[model samples]
Target: MNAPPRIAAPTHAPEAPRLRPDRAEAGALTRLALPIIMARIGLTLMLVADNMIVGHFGAGPLAAFALGLMLVQTSQMLGLGLLMGSAVEMAAAFGRDALDEVGRIWRRALAYALAIGFAGAALSQAAPTIFLALGQEAALAASAGEIAALFGWSLPPVLVYVASIGLLEATGRPYVGVALLIAANLVNLGLGLLLGHGGLGLPALGAFGVTLATLIARITLAGGALAYILLLMPGRQALGRPRWSDHRWADGRRQRRIGYAEGLSLGIESGAFASMTLFAGWAGALQLAAYTISINLNMLMFMVAVGIGGAAAVRVSQARGRGDPAAMARSAATALLLYTGVMLVVGIAFLALPGVFAGFYTGEADLLAVTTPVVAGIGFLSLIDGAQRVVANILRGYGDTWLPTASHLFAYVAVMVPAGYLLALGLALGAGGLILAIALASVLATGLLLARLVQLKNRRS
Candidate 1:
């Protein structure tokens, strides 16, 4: 009886072990990344489709399209960079349980978006002048300028869509943006054909027609994204209604500061590539078309990194909001890991099937000959280019901005530009030389970013 009583001493079960933070972050990052990746890919597809349509029109139109894109895309990146702060700030707010701040941040971002869009539109109107000033052939400059003007008006809608998507992504509603992008692409394709080829009693717009189609599709996308944010998103409840009262100067300043650095960084990088495009142009219309196609394909792959980097940004921002440095480190590491694996597969495919990939964009035998090798160059370029993108975004998440911007300036402007000139012109490497220059710059930028991230981690520790 005594032994039984002793055995009856209270025994409590051990509590379930807590889930590892890194593992939880891995799951969250994956869930967040997949849809964003799809959305990013969808965004790239818009350009791909536009290029293919323009390519079929003729090499001259294709060259003009590429030239127009040099301005349009650089401005687009600048706008996106400025708005990127919305996602970081809102995600941080959500992580720290400051839910109300999320909505306010978005409102401020929207205002900035509209202002930036209008400014970009005005800037785009001068593309022809800019091209001529940059030594582009007069005829080519005029054609490209026309295309640029048509594409320029699309900026407001594009920026609005970007800002809205940022809100949706941070709030765990990324799928909506992906769906909207899908719809936008469909609209673009249908209209692009009708306008581009002049069908259904509609006058063929040529390159301008295709560009106008993009403009219309962008407007549709923006409207849909904004509507969802206002009417359907559950997170909108937390984000609150669009209220003017929410506009506070201090808050807007903080958000804009983030954008300033990122915008400048993106401007530098995009401008550098645009300079390379100019180099290709000097090589001839064929080289320009080849460079354009190769870069677009590489950009498609780069979007994979952007998607993962986006998820990492949210995760790191949230961790920062929670004042947890370790979590931030882990989240970044996880993102890099995912990007590495995905890019590895993509790189291998590019190397193995460069010809097939090149075929999809153009039917010209000469164009394919130039494009295929450049596509293969993308195999190695993707890894370094994508790594830099991910690391830069991670640093942005931590609010460490200007340094990254400086690094980009040095790498792209200082290193890549001259290297591109030397390799493409002096060495007479043409399109392939341009690719090599880009790869070199990307490697430098990636290393700088990684070291910066490591420094931040060590300081935190």
Candidate 2:
């Protein structure tokens, strides 16, 4: 019955008519983006430490760990997408200062995350057998099985960590979530180093030990974050004695419709990457190793872009809540620019010294040789990928999840996978062909998503 309160405009008056929209948007984006970029760099450093420790152990463990990470990341993308999509919804609700709705959204998301986590755990437990049945190489299948076993145990705690992160990001306290990640990763880095090798009186558990370290990190983060949210945040009372209620199937239905759409879209997108990995696997173990190296290096760049995209979602959602279409458009454009600039620099560096980046993963000459071109290709792709992700997030922030989901499905599943399979297998282009297909799909997806965002902005205008 009540209209939402207006967000007060900035108090500081400009002497001149306010700066151009591009300038203002850029300023706002920089303010939000810098912290996110720093956080991502820190997280990347932690992963680098983990990989450095693992790489020292031996190639087999490193390869196994890489495969495990790929499997977990692919499976978890659905849950991650669901959390993020719901977070955008909640961010919009929060920007309207709709506290009651925020609570309901959080509860619903936690329920969804839990269910998804359990299912992911179950699937991960069965992954080795599934891959084997898919006619993978015997050695690779056995290693994949071992990795899956580690992932099965790691799933529940990681899910809790991810769910907590969703709630934190939704409430517009991403800094807190970033802090938790920093602390957890620090612990993981130290423990991984000590236990991964036979250092500091700790018995080396090899890849499994590193997996255990990651599990510990996730549990620690989940526990710490829950405490911060419930006890320490400024508006703790909102969460403390707030209304809790029985499950509303209608709300669940609404969320699932949105969440599942986003989830499946992300799954298809990530599944394409996984399929590429399979294709690369067929080329040779060295090629698979190269694929793993190049991908890990690229993730550093991707993570930064994702953090900005997350902020874009939050900013756009908040703007949408206020019925400020212009501000939403400005925010989206600003985020795209910021992410593009950052990715461009990273991409250039990757292209210039692909081998240098791959060297971080292995000392093997053969693996490095195979990975160089893949890394170079991904560097160019990252620019386009970064732009598309921002555009997609902006749409999502405006509560338009389905369109982007459809776009991703069309681009990744329909185009990327089929193209890559034909090039890699039918035409025998090998790893290079797979990477080329990826580059093409990313460009297409980016262009389509950007066009859609422009059309939506025009309609709103």
Candidate 3:
């Protein structure tokens, strides 16, 4: 019944030296981003593995898995984004050598994460209604709803892991999360096979079993991460113990505000994409299954940008804490530069071998046929999508919150949703049409966000 504590005033420190994208600074950014990139990819691979596993079972289960996952991921992104303020604040604190404040921020963030996670789990219980309201067939909705509710149980543990990882990442210990994620992935793969396919004297539970495996894996990740930080992490003493003073609601308003803007922005963007899946669903099960594979692949590639964006946020937040606008500019520029080169390579691969990539998800020729063009479309989409992603994080790093949310609203909701409806349904373009709408939205979103970042840097400079 106690209110959360208000934020303590910032402890000022002397401004650090200006940093350039010199070899050392760039090297530092690379070192931080690489593990994060691997970790993000590892997280995505778990979903990819689930799709691959379930896809072999038949298109019905795959479609249901996709439907459930799309819904769960929207909620997940909202929670993840809401919790982002933890990393932003902690990184700034670390930059100022305000070690105790970092601990306080983490504690507040963990509470926020748990609250959002539980809320999401509760909402997920209504999946059948949501899908039915969206106009899906009764049978598909029922199957997908079961999958959604089952997978929903993992949200709490997953967010706990996110809160812990955010603190670790902010404090320059990114590798710990990576190790935990790798272990979790291995466990998921093993359990997925055993439960999903009827090995080890158990009946095949299909999608339900696969989801149960994920739930267990997520709990393992949460527990392992908490254990390390609480008992075994270096400087555990400096992390400090939680106190009632740190729990007052009024004290944590600023952190919660950042989380609010981020959660809404991420929710809007993800919800728009989920709508596209619904549109594909209306086109029939074949188109829906194909769209799922294609979009999942796009997300896999997007993780690279997410990693760089995360690293950029930290570097820029650190620069901000040090009162170094020029360094912030350089860091933002460096992240954009790296993101561009990496996306170019990924785009080329997607375009050159779309079928090869599609083949990884399903061996069915009909599904592959429907999915290939969409995969190729994503190659173009990633270029634009990745830019917006990096710039949005750069804005977050600089403490500009609500504007990015507004931009996503305009671009993804205002632009992408109607375009998806028209292109995919109105024009009968099928799954490929859905992807084209995403590209169109990304083009607009990227332009708007890039302009905003430039405006901020110009004012600061």
Instruction: Give the top-scoring candidate (TM-score).
Output: 3
lDDT against the true structure, per candidate, is: 0.86, 0.72, 0.86
Candidate 3 Cα lDDT to native: 0.86
Top-lDDT structure, candidate number: 3
Give candidate 3 regions above 4 Å deviation.
1-25, 96-99, 320-326
Question: How does model 2 score by TM-score?
Answer: 0.87
Point out where model 1 deviates above 4 Å. 1-26, 95-100, 235-244, 319-328, 397-399
TM-scores, in order shown? Answer: 0.90, 0.87, 0.91
lDDT of 1 by residue, 273-348 (tens): 8899999888878889998888988888888888888788878887887888878888888888778878888889
Scored by Cα lDDT, where does model 1 land? 0.86
State how far residue 39 of model 2 sits from its true place (Å).
5.4
Which pairs clash (backbone N, Cα, C closer than 3 Å) in model 1? Answer: none
Candidate 2: lDDT over CA atoms?
0.72
Backbone Cα, N, C clashes tallied per candidate: 0, 0, 10
What TM-score does prediction 1 earn? 0.90
How far off is residue 112 in model 3, in Å? 1.9
Of the two candidates 1 and 2, the one with more favorable lDDT, higher being better, is 1
Sorted by lDDT, highest first, which candidate order results? 3, 1, 2
* Model 1 clashes, total count: 0
